[model samples]
Target: MASESPACNICESIISQTIQTDDRKEIQIARHTVNEHFDRLQRELLKELQIIENDKRKEISKILAPVERKEKEIDGLQISLAIIKQHASDLQTFLVSKQIEHELIDTDNLIQSIQNNSELSGVIVSLQTIGMMKSLGNISRFGQTSQSDMSLVRQKIKQAQAKVAVVTKGSLDHQHGTIKTEEGL
Candidate 1:
């Protein structure tokens, strides 16, 4: 019985050592499993963050694209406005020069008539000429334009362009015009 007791104790000690080794192995396995799961979770999170960043980049580009287009349109409008101003200035200068030439020709004709006619006939002709000159003067002044008038015209053009720009901006940003087509093809 004494020998049997010692054998039993030795068997218990061996069993306990075996259990302890198995427990250590299980702990190591558990630790490895947790580290693997954490690594997978971190990779998935990084992938999700990359996708979110890509979506935000696309959204930001969408928002700024229209602004870039509008800036280009404004540049085109400015170029057109400059051309219009130059043309208006040239036309005004040409018309004023032609008016001065016409006045000089009329004065020359009146002087020739006075020199050819006698005193009494010249007086009658002079009275008739003065009446015609007054009507011509009225006709000439009817459509006369000055620098201030040109400026007013340019101002009106600017106002009209501004209104057009607003309308254009609306159309550029969103579809507005209705489609009109034949009912049947």
Candidate 2:
């Protein structure tokens, strides 16, 4: 019985050690999985943000192109008008002046139209993270660890006891001449 106690203790210890080792392995695997998931999520989020920014930039550029073209045309017209006024005769100046006035009115009307259409309106960019933020905030811990059951250890102890009982019975039978070796000793 005293020897049996030691055997049971050894069996329980081995079982506990095995359980601890498995638990550590499981923890490591879980940590790796979580880290990979967050890493992928971060990459995806950054990609989406970049795409949005690029789209917004394109939209703003589209809005500004016509205005910029009109501004350059007006500058060129002013320079041409000045040259004509300084270098032309009265008849030529009168004709050129009429053409310049029409050009100026058209340019002014285009500018007014752009203003009225709100082409230069402000663009606002923002992230919609309320749900994500709430979900993140709700998380208190990455995971939880739990105690393993002792039923496996108990089962192992029982098997060890059965083997010990068989060995003891075999020895007792041999000593009482109820069991014999193949060759007489």
Compared with the true structure, what per-residue lDDT tens digits does model 1 show for residues 138-175? 76322222223444544555666667779998886555
Q: What is the lDDT of residue 65 in candidate 1?
A: 67
Superposition TM-score, candidate 1 onto the true structure: 0.35
What candidate 2 gets wrong by more than 4 Å, as runs, is 2-11, 89-105, 141-144, 149-159, 162-166, 179-185
TM-score of each: 0.35, 0.67
- Positional deviation of residue 27's Cα in model 2 after best superposition, in angstroms: 2.9
Against the reference, the lDDT scores of all candidates come to 0.57, 0.79
